[model samples]
Target: MAQLIDSLRADGICIIVVTHDMDLVKALDARLVYLIPDRPGAGKVSGGPVQSPDGPDGSRPVLLPVAAMDQRDEPPRRSSRSAYIASINPAFRLIGAFLTALPLLISLDWVSATVALVLELFLLMAAGFTPLRIVRSAWPIFLGAPGSALAIILYGKAGGATYWQWGMIHVTQRSLDLALATALRILAIGIPAIITVLGIDATDLADAFSQVLHLPERFVYGGLAGLRLFSVLRDDWSALSASRRSRGLGDENRFKAFFPQAFALLVLSIRRSTTLATAMEARGFGGTEERTHARVSDVGPRDYVYLLICLAVPVAALATAALTGRISYFGN
Candidate 1:
């Protein structure tokens, strides 16, 4: 890999490697691009020569002043409320999502599900997600909801008066009610969970899981590493498609072409994962000894407040359902 990088550099190709393995950077003698956060939403990159910590004099890497480096303009900041929500501990957000989802998941009637969906929508808006953005991001949920509801109406456990029947497909009044409830329940549970996850930074989540939640560092960091590969996999797919088109294989049957590309992708992923695992082991990633965190993942009063809100949403939904005489348990 180092030889390939060196060869590419010799050919005047810019090979950018994003990694935490400082040893590899030192070995490559690569220029460092440090991203320094200048504001809440903005960062400035400062580049400098990499220094080896294992040098005879044990010199450390130097970070040039922001003014000395080529600087970019600051990005716009989000609303304070939005920023606060985003800053909350990801572990808490995860717990909050679970709390909010429980009631909606078990809801068997339309009223409770409807109430939960409304609350989730309100929460979404409060969290600064616009209606269009929510629809765009959660389009799969929107598209699948109706289809799922239709399936449920057609083939769900039949009860009450029959509305339609054709061969194996049957629709009844009870099925209709259940279908509507199911659709609303999906929206109520899925939207907020997706939004919460999208809002979290992968690195921040890993840090929270490791430092705040006391999860195994190996597992947390491994997951983070895998998540980072998603973008790489997307680019690889695009490149693979382009290569196939250039090779006159694009006109081949789509299903048949897919199998080869999928196999190639799997091979590429496995190779990358193996390389990453080796690098991580070299960096003492899976060591049994205690590891110190560079970033602190402390929970504060605001986090507690966020947790309370998470707890309150489901409680309120359930209470409202009970008052309306609409609460139906899972097996009712």
Candidate 2:
């Protein structure tokens, strides 16, 4: 049961299981989903009692006993409370995630980027995202930034007093500054964007998007389904890439081989999409009713502060450049 839950978690599936087997529920670490049922006399809580584990000292356990899903005769039917809460509005999570990426998109100054990166790091730390994961995710940005900066230096020399000239190219002091600025800008934007979204859980993101952002329910659910499938496809792609390398296919890298592999991945993605769609439809998704939150996403006061700083830093940098005559608007 623990393994099953782990697998479901890895696949980014949101599941609310029902079971009478107490041990299984404990094993699965499932959360109790309470539902209030309408009775003839009065309304009463229809869900089963919430049980919790005892502590190491035999005190009451911290977490409540949630239902475990099981394959058995006469499976437990979902109650209104259980079903309603189980389906989280994906809008909030999605919108929040997108907004979190905003700082990286607009900020250009090193100071702005630096501040944004720090704030994003703070959020990740607060949200329990591992530092190792953050570092691992942010490294690629540095790897690519230099190359992009080099491109700007090589190509952005038009109308500059050429210090050195070659075929279709010129090098100047201004070009050097432009290269450094471009590299810094890229690093500033890329690092925060990656870290802010790296630890996001897809189902929670979907729920947040639906509830907070008021996105169309069908679109939110569809995106969730796609995200789940993408995880599987990414894993498959990695495996196939490795296998091909081992089989000497990687040794013979030609245009033909690349096209076929790309095509194969496309076909695999389509098949996975079809299979996921059919499975979701079979499970009675998109039922006629308003969805409720299984969990809620909140933007803390810290997020607002960070957003303000993201907006302010670039403005400050521009202001500083203006006062110092260092700011050149796109070399105009």
lDDT of 1 by residue, 160-270 (tens): 999899998889998898899889888877877777666576776898899888988888898899998788988999888999999999999999999999998899899
Predictions: Cα RMSD each: 8.7, 13.8
Model 2, 22-82: lDDT tens per residue? Answer: 6865676654544332333222223535445553345553333332222113332221122
lDDT on C-alpha atoms for all candidate structures: 0.77, 0.57
Error of 1 at 235 (Å): 6.7
Residue 82's lDDT in candidate 1:
59
Q: How far is candidate 1 from the true structure (C-alpha RMSD, Å)?
A: 8.7
* lDDT score, candidate 2, position 252: 73
